[model samples]
Target: MISKDTVKEIKILALHIRMETMKAIGNLGFGHIGGALSITDTIAALYGGAMKYDPKNPQWEQRDWLVCSKGHAGPAIYSALALKGFFPVEELLTLNKPGTNLPSHCDRNLTKGIDMTTGSLGQGASLAVGVALGHKLDGRDNFTYLILGDGEIQEGQVWEAVLFAAQKKLDHLITFVDYNKKQLDGYTKDINDVGDIKSKFEAFGWHGQEIDGSNVIEIIEAIENAKQHKDKPSVIVLHTIKGKGWAFAEQELFNHHMNISRDQMEEALTVLSAELEGLVKE
Candidate 1:
């Protein structure tokens, strides 16, 4: 179980992720806002305490690995890494700019803490499976965590990787599906829905569960449960809001990729700043 102090810490980290992500995207006045913000809590849950790593030695052997298969959410991962001391928080503003390490999509070669370079949808699943199997082969207990988008799973490559992961009994591989219900052009339900992802993963011979994606305690508890079960890989279906923590984006129908004007960004920040202040004071 997650301790009270740990929960508070996660909450703080989640706020930082949200703020930095907004600031980074707000710098360019546009980005994949909806998806980037959606995974904030999950990213916080991992970096807050769940994952092991040394910012100074990002490639530490004993460290846990994360694959953000939904690579467009690079801003959120970048924010978490920066907050964790992987790099200067100021560099976050360089996102997607020429010669900058933080690209629009995650690139291991460019970023300090990124494990596998991921941009193409569903490809991260394959890379994550390989990372887990490699660890198992080398007799390492490190866990490989993967985050997939609900829309990304529509690709056949994701299913192939899922089948392979279960076949290998990769118990160390934990996958989180960001089921925010919105895709780029339309709602997931209206645009080729993969109904019941948890059951689908279970049918493929993996332990799967669905949970409230934005809840820090539930997210941590679910991760603990996934770690406890040893046999096949585990998949957690995160029922999340597409644009969580941001008022304007939350109500947008086509929020997958949208423009973030300065006023809109600051509006979101005002709300976040107040909550962050309250949390810190508590």
Candidate 2:
């Protein structure tokens, strides 16, 4: 079981990721905030303690790898990486700028700790499966984590990868589906409903589970469960809200890719600051 103190730390880390992500995208004056913020908690859970990683040795052979299939959420990973010492925290503000290592999407060659580069939907799943199969064949126990956007699963390639992972019995490949209900065009349901995602994965021969993606404790515990299962790959459906942790963005239906005014960004930072203080004191 995770200690309460540890849970608090993870929670703080989640908030920090959200704040940093806002600052980074906000600095650009426009970026993928809604989708990015939705996965902050999951990223925090992974970087906080669920995943084994070394900031100084990012290429550590024993380390588990993360593939952000929904690559628009790169800022969230950048924020966590910076906070975990993968890079200077101040560099987060350089997101999407010229000559910046941090792009709007994740790129392994540019980023230090990113395992797989992704932007086009449904591709990360295949990359993650390949990595997991390779590690498993080498007798390595490190996990390959794949973070997929719910809407991205509409791609035929995603299901193809899902079938392949299950058939190979890549037990170490743990997948997270960000069911944020919104996508670029509009709400996922309105665009293309990937109905009953957990059921779909289970039918495809995966060990599937669902949980609150926003709660750090739940995310950590769910990951522990995913790690314990063997003989089949596991998929955790994370029910999340787009533009999560931000009061204004949460209410916007088309928050997928929206511009944040300077005033909105400052207000969000101020609110998060107080929330962080309260969490610390508690």
- Prediction 1 global C-alpha lDDT: 0.95
lDDT by residue (tens digit), candidate 2, 44-126: 89999999999999999999999999999999999999999999999999999999999999999999898889999999999
Q: Which one wins on lDDT?
A: 1
lDDT of 2 at 200: 96
Tens-digit lDDT track for model 1 on 1-282? Answer: 568899999999999999999999998999999999999999999999888899999999999999999999999999999999999999999999999999999999999999989889999999999999999999999999999999999999999999999999999999999999999978999989889999999999999989999999999999999999999899999999988999889999999998999998999999999999999999
lDDT of 1 at 185: 79
Clashing pairs in 2: none
- Report model 1's TM-score to 2 decimal places: 0.99
CA lDDT, every model vs. true structure: 0.95, 0.94
Worst 10 residues of 2 by lDDT: 182-191
